[model samples]
Target: MYVTEYPKGDVDKEIDKLNKKLSRSFSKDATQVIRKLQKANCDALGIGRHLIAFYPNTWKEKDKNEYLRNVKFKTNVDVEIVQVGIAE
Candidate 1:
């Protein structure tokens, strides 16, 4: 994480809050990307591979190539600010 100005109050707490907000933003973006991919019937994430390997019966029940569109995706993102770069 890089900041032009250091947080004015409670540096640690502010960084933590920023991290949470960033995580949520990233997760939302990921979900949007996933939806776009599913709409195009593009399994760029290889979700089908996991389903076929572990849940063969479930995979068999859906249309082989068109199943992703109907699948539900739960996305979680965690962000960590390992190094905070402050410009001089």
Candidate 2:
């Protein structure tokens, strides 16, 4: 996933738009994949071993934090901030 904003229009608006997209892209289908695997697991589901690589955009510090927080707090997955911005 990539979060980015060019130097045009309103940055906040762009960030908000990106946030909305981010929230929707990684959906319940992802969870389902894990669930199916767990159904066959002999022991622990061990979803915590999986990494949900999250790379949300830059500040709107509050919004960015909230987005990442929701992903981390709401899910059993461990998310890693792999990168910020599209490039550089």
Candidate 3:
């Protein structure tokens, strides 16, 4: 997922817009996927891991979840469909 934003906008509003966009894009199976990931205690987004990689010292001093809670994420996904079969 990738996000491009206007240089000057309300940060929280921009984040909300991005979240809504992502939710719409992944609406079909998003709930189920979220439930499964939460149940498994998995961070499929790699957010924690990425933070650790980029800010090892800071990560080592703080809880990953706490850090995650303070960070904002924006994502974009592209979907392509190909080869629809004839109905029986």
lDDT of each: 0.82, 0.42, 0.58
Query: Per-residue error at 17 for model 2, in Å?
Result: 2.9
Model 3: lowest-lDDT 10 consecutive positions: 78-87
TM-score for candidate 3: 0.41
Residue lDDT tens for model 2, 1-88: 4435456555445665655555555555556654555455421433232322232223323342233223322333323333346465
Q: What would the per-residue lDDT of candidate 1 be over residues 11-88, giving only the tens digit for each residue? A: 465888878888999999999999999999999998889989999998888898788898899998888776665566
lDDT of 3 by residue, 1-88 (tens): 3444446664345666656655677864665665566566578878678868897887798765555445544433433332222335
At residue 15, candidate 3 shows an lDDT of 61
Candidate 3, residue 67: lDDT: 55
Supply every candidate's count of residue pairs whose N, Cα or C atoms clash at under 3 angstroms.
0, 0, 0
Return whichever of 1 and 3 wins on lDDT: 1
| Global lDDT of model 1 | 0.82
Kindly indicate the candidate among 1 and 2 with the higher TM-score. Answer: 1
Superposition-based RMSD of candidate 1 using all C-alpha atoms, in angstroms? 3.0
| Most accurate candidate by lDDT | 1
Lowest summed lDDT over 10 consecutive residues: which window, candidate 1? 2-11
